[model samples]
Every structure is written in structure tokens, then in C-alpha cells.
Target: MLRVSIAQISPDGTKEENADKVEALIRMARGADLIVFPEYSLGARLEHADRLAEPVDGPLIRRLAAAARESGLAVIMGILESAEGGPYNSVVLMANGDAIVAHRKILLFDALGSIESRYVRPGNMPLTLVRLGEFTVGLATCFELRFPEIFRSLAAAGADLFVVPAAWYAGNLKEEQWLVSAASRAMENVAYLVAADSAARAFVGRSLVVNPWGHVELDLGKGERLVAWEISRDAVDEARSALPLIEMANQHMGTWARVRRIY
Candidate 1:
């Protein structure tokens, strides 16, 4: 069984305040194998363009690395990254003080009231896959959830589990979108879906675990909470055996392409 912890808490503008909250939750995890955190929940700087990105050796990632090494834990954390003259939204995966992968968010949310495009650079890499013991883990951020192609790429790369760390904004029926997207992704790819959402006033929290069979194994309500669940590797195989969506997906391949010029 693989144990997972989701930290669903609102974040303040101060780094110390956010880090303290995360540290408290990390300590509560106890024996969890993987712990997931929400996007930009370490500090609220959605409007700030300059002070976003921190180096791998910087305080943001360094702090997470220390926690991982001390607790023998694996973490999937979302942080704003600064690069050259621009900032980027990224998910950094760490294990035992080592960063295994850094997936820069490809889809930037600039439409409507979002100014992400002004500060952040759009990523070009496809969904990145990381090996975790016996299973391959996949990654995707908040806005990336709207695109099914990224998920398909990860599934094609042999990912058995998908981790989504998001600060999903609240809306009239946004919760439904989360439910549908999670279930559909799991069912379509026959993989486990673990989502960590922020419980801030602007962002609704509802961290969840969905099995390959599209079942909700764990659900954290719209409140600040620490939720954990165990999943079996055999369950992944059994789901794929019963419904071979992974194999069937090959028939509908080559449909999505990278956007060359944004309008």
C-alpha cells in the first residue's frame, strides 16, 4: 500500500506563515510515502511578477528538500519559479533531498482577470513522468487540467498515478468540473488520480483520491485539512485488466499539437 497526504490550507503572503502551516501538516503525515501540496499555497503572490522564482538551491525548494530528507518522504510541491527576467509556475518533485523532476506549467492562465502571461513564461515540454519505486508517476498543475492531451501523454508514457497540485479558483459550479475531470482522467487512463487543492477563500479545497476504476477512495471537504489514503499496486493492474482504456486510447492518438502562436 502507498500512503499519500494532502495539505489543504489557505496561504498568506508571508513565506514564514505559509511554511509554518505546511510544516505542521507534514508532521501530521507520519508514515505517508507521498505528500502533495497545493499550487502557490506556500505564499500568495499571484499578482507579484518579480519575486516568484527561487533557485533549486533557494529557500523554497531547499526547505522542502530538508523535510523530505528528515522524514524520508517524497513530495510533490507547487511553487512559483523565477527564471532570467520572467517567472514560471512549476511543480517540483523531491525525494531524500534530491529533486527528481521539475515540471514547468505549460498552459498559462492569462484570460479573463488573470495576468499570468505578463510575468510567467509558457512551458514547451510535454507532461513529465517520474519513476517512483514500481510505478511511474505523472504531473499536471491547475490550468493544465483543462487539457486532456497532457494527461494522455503521461498515460502513454506508462504512468500508473497522476498527481495534480492546484489552487483551483472558486466558481458557481467549479466543484463539478473537478469531480468530472478527475473521474474521467482516471477512467480513461486506468490510473489513480490524487489531487491536492487549496482551501483558501478564493480557492476551494477538496483534495481527493480516485482509483483506476473511477472510485473516490478519499475525499477531503472544502476546509483546511490533512487527508491520507492507501492505494494498492494490484488495484491498478486489476482496473486496467477490466477496462483496457490505455490500450484503446492508441486508436485516438495524434490529435493534439503545441500552440505555436498565442492570440
Candidate 2:
């Protein structure tokens, strides 16, 4: 089993404040294998991404690496990752002094009266999955959850655990959709899924986990929280054997243009 924590906290402060919070969060997740943070967890708001974006190897990231290295833990968190043209709504994973852009949001959030493309550039990176002990962890961002193709691509590439971090907007049925989408993705792929969403006033704060069998294992309702759960690879195996849906439907599931794997 792998212990994973979701830092369901909003990035509603300055860069230094957010970075400090991240360090404190690492300290809080002392015993967990990995921790996941919501999208825009460093930028006070998505609108500020243009001005606040930082390179993968920038000082801010190096500081984050130092924190992770000190804690001897790994973390997945959203950042306004600097790139050509503009920033990418990117999620970075840091472990043992190594950090990489796990996945850039290929599908930007442009619906529900919000156009993320205004400041955020669409990512062309392939699907990224990480190896943690016995499980392959898939990483994706907020808006990507609406598209099952990305999750399916991760599963097709041998992912057993999926992580999604989001700044999901609050709207009529939006919360319901967030819950359903997270669970549906896990069920269809027979993989465990952990989704962390911003707890800010504008976004839904219901961070959740769905087991390999598509059961809601934990639901962190409304507000900042650091919750952890142990996920089993054996459960994924059992779900595949009992359901047999992935084998039958994988061929039809759309694939990403490319795929990348990391340790």
C-alpha cells in the first residue's frame, strides 16, 4: 500500500506564502509516500499566472526540491510553469531532489464562461506516469478530468493510480460533476484515483478518492484539509479480474499522441 495525501488548500496568497505553505505541508505529510496539491496552488489566482509563472529549474522550484529532499518525501502540486508564448497549467512532482513536469494540461479549461487560454498556453506534452514502489501513478490537472481520453491513455500506459489536481469552478451541478467524473474515470480504468481541488470560495472544495472498484473511499468536503489513504495495487488487479471491462474496452479508448514514464 502507498500512503497519499491531498492538500486541499487554496493558493490565495503571495508566492512566498504559498511556497511556505507547501513546505509546512511537506512537514505535515511526513510519513506519506506522496502528497497532491490543487491546481494554481502557487499562483494566487489563475489570472496571475502570466506574471507569476516560473521555470521548472527556477529558484522557486529549487526551493521546493529542497523542501522535498529535507522531508524525504515526494509531492505533486500545480504551478504556473514557465514556457514559450506563455505559461502552462502544469503540475510538477518533486522527490529526492528531482523534479519534473508530470503533465501539462493539454485540454485547457475554456468552458463555463472562463477562457484559460487567455493567459495559459495549451500543453503539448505527452501523458506522464510515475513509478512508486509497485504502482504506476498517473498525473493530470483540473480541466483534464472532463476528458476521459487522458485518463484512459494513462491506464493504457500501465497506470494503476491516478492523481488529478484542480481549481474546479463552483456552479450548479459542477460539484456533482466533479465527484462523478473522478469516480467514473477510476471505474472505467479500474484504477485508484485521487483528486484534489482548490478550497477557495470560487471553486468547489470537495477533494475525493475513488478505489479501484469505483467506490468512494474518502470525500473531504469543503475547506482546506490534509487527508491520506493507503491504496492497494492488488485491488486494481482484483478489479480487473472481476470486472474485465478494461480489457474489453481499452482498444476503443483513445490514446495520447505520445506517452512518457518516469521513476
Error of 1 at 19 (Å): 2.0
Question: What RMSD value applies to candidate 1?
Answer: 4.1
Error of 2 at 94 (Å): 0.4
In terms of TM-score, the best-performing candidate is: 2
Compared to the true structure, candidate 1 yields what TM-score?
0.90
Candidate 1 runs further than 4 Å off: 251-263
TM-score of each: 0.90, 0.93
The whole-model lDDT of each prediction reads 0.79, 0.87
Residue-level lDDT of model 1, residues 1-263, one tens digit each, is: 68888888888657667777776676677688888999875665667646545666677667767777777778888877666667678887888787634688888876547767777788756678877766789999887777888888899889999999898877877888878888888878899999898888887678889999888888898888887788888999988889888777676555533346677
lDDT of 2: 0.87
Best-matching candidate per lDDT: 2
lDDT score, candidate 2, position 33: 88
